[model samples]
Target: MIFILIVTLLIYAGLVFYVAWSGYRGIGIKGNRWFLIAYSIIMLFLSVSFILARFGSGSTLLAVIGNYWLALFSLSLMILPLVHLIMLILRLTSLHREKTRVAAARIAFVVLVAALAYGSYMAYTPKVNTYTIDIDKSYPEDLNVVMFSDTHFGYLSGKKHAERLVKEVNELEPDLIIIPGDIIDDDLEIVEKKQIFNILGGLEARLGVYGSLGNHDKFRGELSELITAIETANIEILYDETVTIEGGLALIGRKDYSEGERLATEQLTSQLDQSLPIILLDHQPYEYDEAEQAGVDLVVSGHTHRGQVMPGNLITNRLFENDWGYLKKGQLHTIVSSGYGFWGPPIRIGTQSEIVQIHINFNN
Candidate 1:
């Protein structure tokens, strides 16, 4: 994992440098020393700002600038490549190379800005995605399960975001609310500083709020402390634990995959009555067949964020069987949320922040 991260950073740094140089040259401003210097400085700062923020710089200004710069940087990388391709195609025409470069550069800038604008709007707007599924098992009444993941409640998803989640979730009048994982961002202290827990405590659902520890949540604090904090907020944070809700169905929450060796799905469900419906919450979506074989009726997950941004989702789609949305294998139903909040940059392209609403209709 460390090696992969290092290689990814190197590749990212190289692409960023190439884009910075290409953009500067494309604008036909090579002769303006002052302009070049100013541009270089800004690019350099933006490039390293995220690293600074991640390393505990503890500056909101740096966090804002760095995170937003990441979004802009991603857009630039995507748009600049297409712009270059367009310019290359235009070389066949009568247009001069320099003029085409300048035109392409301007077009790229406009498109980048527009893409960022769209992505930012989508990121802030949380949508309720409803899914209705029929279960063969019999229950007294239908269950309205409202689930969302990856809130990352730090600088990006603070008070306002929590309030939005509570308000929207309550308005739905769900019987249950499930946060698969990633309730906190990277820092646990930020939750207290922002009074995010107080706001999240406002969440109203009949079954109450329940969540499992995500990979990000694992990094925030000690397992016991994090679980206590979440439970104190009226959320039940399960760790390799199973509970019988209303003595009707069983819900199992597993430790994250990064937690070394967690319990297997079949092992966790072995003791539970096979007749009762079973739901599992595993942060990262993996080993679907195991869940299905274990007689798990449903599984919820939220790690991928469905590529959170354009082209990023394209990669995630290939990595997981069901990166986002619902997938059923045999009798098991899996729903992977794209996430309610973002990671590095508070922006999402080709995807929107979502809360999943699964209306389970059991056979009478």
Candidate 2:
């Protein structure tokens, strides 16, 4: 962990320096040297503060301050690109009048900044995504399934986020809720355990909630304990097992790939009726081809978090057949959510946490 932290800090420091250099090159060394130095120092201090809070001796206050500073720094970083874009646009317009060009550039900058700020606010706000799937099953027509994954339930996702998630799930009037793993982080014992459970229990699902073992859940050695806790909260756990939902839909939960346990496709295949629709809840979406070949009608997964940072989604897409969002592989329908919580850094740079509402319709 210490070595990982050192490597991460070094990478972040390098990124900060690169951004500073880029900004200096754009504005010229003599013109914006002071601005570059100020921004660089701010970025370095914020990065160091956050790293210290995580690994070294630093208080929560320092971390909070660092987070705020980083948020401001992110805005400033956006400003650089927006400014350059505006200048380029003005230059293209053939506006020779210096005063007019400057005025127009200033207006464009303000508009761009305002738009970005609004976008950031909207991105932070909770958004519900609804999807419909026709599985030709005997499930109830109004049966709603609330699916949430990658709720890293630690520093970033606390009681408030869990409560909001519960409230949103309840609003969907779901009959069954599915959490495809990574429900909690490493510090589950020290984290907001009761509050998260309380909110989870408050969910109004008649068929109850189900969870699969995620990588983090296994890493923390809290797999059995978390299952017990969720079961105590009235949610059923299907670890490498299949549970029939009374409506011709078989929900199969598989352990994380890291568990070294082979995919439970054979086990589920033996138990599942060929006439019924089978939905496989696997944490990572990597092995969809096998799942599709195994006759899984739908596969729900998380784990990738859609590259929670910049270029992450692109990289993850390359690694997996379907890393984020929805994809149909032959006869299998696969949906990989970015997730309701974040991992590693609390800040989600390019991806937002999500809850997917899947409405299943039977074909007549």
Candidate 3:
């Protein structure tokens, strides 16, 4: 964890510095003293935000402010390199360069603002993606399963968001609902302040709404309360356990990797009737072979958030075999959600926030 923080700080700090230097050089020519003062103030704000947000007393509001600031700043960094490239070329060619640099800077700012605006809207507009899969099994009915992960009902969203989600899910009239984790981002204070738990209690599922833990749910060392809160909302935490739903299929929910894995996939599935179809709810895509070998029919997971933001999605795709969608290998199938909510930045660039609707049919 510390290593990750260190790396993030280092990288963000480097980007901040690069932005500062570029601004001083390019935009400074417009005005000297006022530009320097404004530049220093913005840098100070960003620096203070990073320091207090990470090392201070963990305020949700501060965290929220820091998140959007960092997000906008991060996206701005993407365009900075292009501006730098253009400036470099102008320097080399040395012909009408000042006007060109100013023009490039103006265009980049407009592009940055436009991108951020679009990303902001996309972040909140959660969409439902549908999938139809036929599992080879003899059963009496078709199972409509609604699965979503990373609701993250804390800072970016609140009780209204919870209510909206329940309404959306209930409208689908699902037999079962599965969540793969990250129901809340961090800090129970925000959860309590927003009454997110009570709002979430509104969720209704015929078979029951089942879920597993995610890293952020345990991030602030508040797993116990989060669990209590979830149970209070009538959402069952599966936590390395299995429950047979509607008398036909086994639903296995695994512990988040943050928590130690208590049982192997085989052990979890070993006691179940082999003839029945088995589905797994794991917060992350872990031990695929173990689940597949154990005769698990489908493994549902989220946590990659389909990279949540761009370029990051590229990294996520490389990290997981099925990072953002459905994949089938032999008899085992996997479905990963991009998630229904945003973390940190509350922005989705070149990615989406989504819920999965799976219509599963059994041959019998």
TM-score of each: 0.94, 0.74, 0.92
- Assess each prediction's global lDDT (C-alpha) against the native: 0.88, 0.72, 0.82
Question: Model 2, poorest ten-residue lDDT window?
Answer: 115-124
Residue pairs whose backbone atoms clash in candidate 2: none
* Model 3 misplaced stretches (Cα beyond 4 Å): 1-8, 29-38, 48-51, 90-95, 219-222
TM-score of 2: 0.74
Model 2: per-residue Cα lDDT over 1-364, one tens digit each: 9999889878766767655555445433455667767977766676667557555554547755655545544554655566666667777676775655456545645754574465344334556778887775555554577899988775546777888888888988887888898887655553544467767778778777888878887434545776786576566778899988865678899988888866557667677886778888999886777787778888899999888655567899899888888888787888988888776545555677788988877754
lDDT of 1 by residue, 163-202 (tens): 9999999999989988889998878887788998888888
Ranking by TM-score, best first? 1, 3, 2
Q: Write the per-residue lDDT of candidate 3 for residues 218-316, one digit (tens) a residue.
A: 546556767887888888998888887776788888888777847888998998897899999888887788888999999999999888778889999
